[model samples]
Target: MNGFKKFLFRGNLVELAVAVVVGAAFSGLVTAFVNSFIGPLIALVGGKPDFSDLAFTVNGTKFPYGGFLTALISFLIMAVVIYFLVVLPVAKLLERLIKAEEATERPCPHCLSDIPIKATRCKFCTSDLATAPTP
Candidate 1:
């Protein structure tokens, strides 16, 4: 029970659960957007807003290819929205955060080569830096 509890409350498990919930919510919103707005735009071009209802009968069997098309469009729209909205912004934020830290890197005293602030010895020049103070 203790081990199960630990696993249940683990950081990754919680994060994944949250992610799944958010993703489901986002998917719903995207689906709504496509149905409400994009569907009309599609209707303007074609009589049908969604292809889900458009199907053909073959040998008295219905092939619902329209539903597949609708699902495909939904998936594509969701992917585009996630990439442009979430992924791009998050990546830019991470890049900015990393750039700030990278800008603070100190150079090696002996070789003038770039080194981390906490580095005690210069990797480029092999300088012994026993007395060197981190800035």
Candidate 2:
């Protein structure tokens, strides 16, 4: 019982729950934005973009696929927004924090290995690079 309490209240579990709640809230915002703004724009193109109204009847049975369209579009927009707004910035920040050696360092002439700038010798191949970095 004690172990179960510890497991339930673990930092990762709590953080995950918080993230899920926040994500759901953000998704609501995205849905509202898409429905209020983008929906009209799509309606202009698709003729009544409220997919809920767009439907078909098969053997006197109505098949409402407009709702599916709305949901798919909303989901796609949410994915794009999250990717660009959250994932991209985080990735760029981490990249900046841990700079890649190859980006700033020069490639060795002999072995094509990455080495420090202004290095006179290629550490990987032990080749003289005094004449490297040709003008």
Candidate 3:
């Protein structure tokens, strides 16, 4: 039971929950913006751009093409906003942090092993080499 609890309530789970909440909030914001601003603007230009009404009946069923377009636009806007506002910055920040964590002082050219940056000779082989940046 303890192991199960630990597995279910890990850091990744918390992060996933946060991400879901943020995504929902962001999607809601984009949908509100599109409904309030873009929808009216498009309606003004195209003469009543309500997707719900811009459909046709075939046989007995109506195909809601305009609603589909509205949904598609909302999805696109949400994706673009999340990509630019969250994913890109977080990826770049993680990359920089990883690079900083992996950085070393230097390495010995003689033995091709890690050594102190200011060392005059390779600690393993005891060979003095020209002072230069480690490859």
Q: Write the per-residue lDDT of candidate 2 for residues 16-135, one digit (tens) a residue.
A: 999999989987887787778777887898777656777999999999998998778777876887788779999999998787434557888779898888788888899998785732
The residue-level lDDT of candidate 2 at 50 comes to: 56
The best candidate in terms of TM-score: 1
TM-score of candidate 2 against the unseen true structure:
0.60
Q: What are the per-residue Cα lDDT tens digits for candidate 1 across 16-70?
A: 9999999899878877876787778778987776788878999999998999998
Candidate 2's displacement at residue 1, Å, is 2.2
lDDT of each: 0.81, 0.81, 0.78
Q: What is the lDDT of residue 131 in candidate 2?
A: 83
Instruction: List candidate 3 segments past 4 Å from native.
Output: 57-61, 80-135
Can you give the lDDT of residue 66 in candidate 2?
A: 82
Displacement of residue 103 (Cα, Å) in model 3 is 7.8
Q: If the candidates were sorted by their TM-score against the true structure, best first, what order would they fall in?
A: 1, 2, 3
Task: Supply the TM-score for candidate 3.
Answer: 0.56
Cα shift from native, residue 15, model 2 (Å): 1.6
- Against the hidden true structure, what lDDT does model 1 obtain? 0.81
